[model samples]
Target chain A: GDQVEQSPSALSLHEGTGSALRCNFTTTMRAVQWFQQNSRGSLINLFYLASGTKENGRLKSTFNSKESYSTLHIRDAQLEDSGTYFCAAGSNTGYQNFYFGKGTSLTVIP
Target chain B: AQTIHQWPVAEIKAVGSPLSLGCTIKGKSSPNLYWYWQATGGTLQQLFYSITVGQVESVVQLNLSASRPKDDQFILSTEKLLLSHSGFYLCAWSHGLGGATGQLYFGEGSKLTVL
Candidate 1:
């Protein structure tokens, strides 16, 4: 079984719309990090949450360690937001090694 | 704050040829380093990790090997390349401390094509 699983393998949204991406962990995680892979294949870190929620610009993320799940929300989507989003969880075993999800491909059409 | 650097932004090698990729970390000492491979439209797979110099651990060996010859450098290599080895290789590092919730910083990544 996968340690981390992401939902909606692919998503499409019109400009000005909003949507959310979710990641479910099979085990307890110490922390979660969200990233967005741009067209150039460079990954940009969106959020790093030990717990609770964090927001930046039109993006927001929440990490529920007890529930073993995390969510990334995009508001008022723009074309520039189109990319593959990934969530990785670091276990509490002190290894600091992360298990990454398969990622969610998002497309914001104008 | 720390920075990670991966070399040879892109590489192309024929099957049976040798391969090597380099990564270096700056502004951090004894950081935990990792090597990851991402296939086309697939998930990122952990290949190797190192906690300190001269000690490397293989997580998912795909006929590849890694070395941490220095405190801040990690290298991934293979004696011979396979067509299936083509993909994006990422180098990452993090602060290795218990209960220290630091984000892993990744380099620009190296794209390899084993033709």
Candidate 2:
């Protein structure tokens, strides 16, 4: 069973365009973390949301814990943003508990 | 400036052979350490985590064990490998602040191939 469901397993965007990626959880989660896995296989933490929303540069993320979902918005997409984006869900119930979605592969082309 | 490092970027071993992987975190003391695995074309799954030296907990068992020998070091090992063990292994560290747990910081990840 998939605890965390990610939408748009793959996505393509034109430079300067923008879009959003989402992760829906099967149950309430304590927090959510968005990551961009680079070609080097390093997972770069983009945003960590316990609730509400956060914005960094052109990237924005929102976590609706009560709704069991989280979203990541990319604005003015750039080529450097091409990579696999992953959403990991955490819970406050247990120690080091987490759930993950496979990922959303994004590519920005000129 | 906290930095996490996973050793042996990639490795290959045969079935029945012993295996060991290591991760080290610098600039952060007593950070929660975790081991996550991703099979090729599969979703990421957490294997184990440690909150302090000499204490570790397993989230998912894949015939592997993890240990925290020092506040800054975490290790993963198995006495016998299975082909199913081949995948990408990531090491992460997390710390709580302002009464809340923070984002997980991951290393470059170690690739394993079992024949």
The best candidate by DockQ is: 1
Worst 10 residues of 1 chain B by lDDT: B95-104
lDDT of 2 by residue, B35-93 (tens): 99999866689999988899999989899999999999999999999999999999998
> What would the per-residue lDDT of candidate 2 be over residues A4-93, giving only the tens digit for each residue?
999889999999999999999998888899999888778888998889999999999999988889999999999999999999998763
TM-scores of the candidates in the order shown: 0.96, 0.94
Highest TM-score: give the candidate number. Answer: 1
Off by over 4 Å in 1: none
lDDT for each candidate structure: 0.91, 0.90
Model 1 C-alpha lDDT versus the unseen true structure: 0.91
Segments in model 2 whose C-alpha atoms lie over 4 Å from true places: B96-100
